[model samples]
Target: MNKKFYFKSYKTKVTINGETITVSRKGFFNLVLLRLRTQVINLNNIQNVKLKEATNFKRGYLKFVVTKGLKHRNVTVIFNVFENEIAVEMKNYIQTINNK
Candidate 1:
């Protein structure tokens, strides 16, 4: 089964299936900024995953670090504290995948 997360405020959606993770963006502004693109990263190419837990004062983000010199750019999703649970889950899942 694919695990999915949607962050409405950021206009982004994330999906994890098998050994790959996909990040997609939506909304008119995001499209105008050329951020409305889909990025897929193979678990094996991910070097690290970071999750900055959100607090009352600030929002948090989830980031994926890919191997150096690769065509794939790093992926980041900004989210509010309410969305932190899924972000943490994604971070853990990716880390476990990289360790195997």
Candidate 2:
């Protein structure tokens, strides 16, 4: 799967329909950490995606609330996108996913 983009620490690898996003955090003592915590959101399962924008430089963050309804809990992802270019692209791409 080709990586469409990177949102802060998360790498988004998109296929034809859905995408797998992965984020890895370092363990204690600078040890290498495995990626056991990856968020997989099927585009078909996504009910809604809401965005929250930051106002200032100190608070420039991109937030997405993916609602899957009652069957599954909602997922909230926050990315520190210092610039708006990538943020807008990601938002639009996600919107497109919803439309499909």
Candidate 3:
């Protein structure tokens, strides 16, 4: 059996307390990730925001992770334009392990 690898790009929306956040576009994952990192650590004083990873053709791949106050959540997803589909994997353990 051949193992299948998944990597997709898509926009992510995050809403908290009835507020909507906008995710960035493709080829801007690094910038977004750095911003989120700062927000999580309270360095930038960002209370809420959306982080997104987009793949621009053969250029490269991106990953995103966002953290807030006492709550931790990760949106693991893959998007394929060729197949017109989005795949997601949720790893709840990330938050639990980091809490220690």
- For each candidate in turn, the TM-score is 0.81, 0.55, 0.21
* True-structure lDDT of candidate 3: 0.32
Q: List per-prediction Cα lDDT, in the order shown.
A: 0.81, 0.49, 0.32
Alpha carbon lDDT of residue 45, candidate 2? 65
Q: After superposition, how far is residue 47 of candidate 2 from its true place, in Å?
A: 1.1
Q: By TM-score, highest first, what's the ranking? A: 1, 2, 3
lDDT of 1 by residue, 1-100 (tens): 5888898877888998888888999888567875558888887788778789998889899888887465656678888888888788878877776676
- What CA RMSD would you report for each candidate? 2.2, 5.1, 12.4
Q: Give the range where candidate 1 is weakest over 10 consecutive residues by summed lDDT.
A: 67-76
Native-to-model Cα distance after best TM-score fit, residue 47 in candidate 1, in Å: 0.4
Shift of residue 45 alpha carbon in model 1, Å: 0.7
Candidate 3 clashing pairs, residues 3+ apart or interchain: 8-79
Q: What tens-digit string does per-residue lDDT give for candidate 2 at 1-100?
A: 3335554433332222355333232334223333333456656666555566545543344444445566754554444445456666766887776675
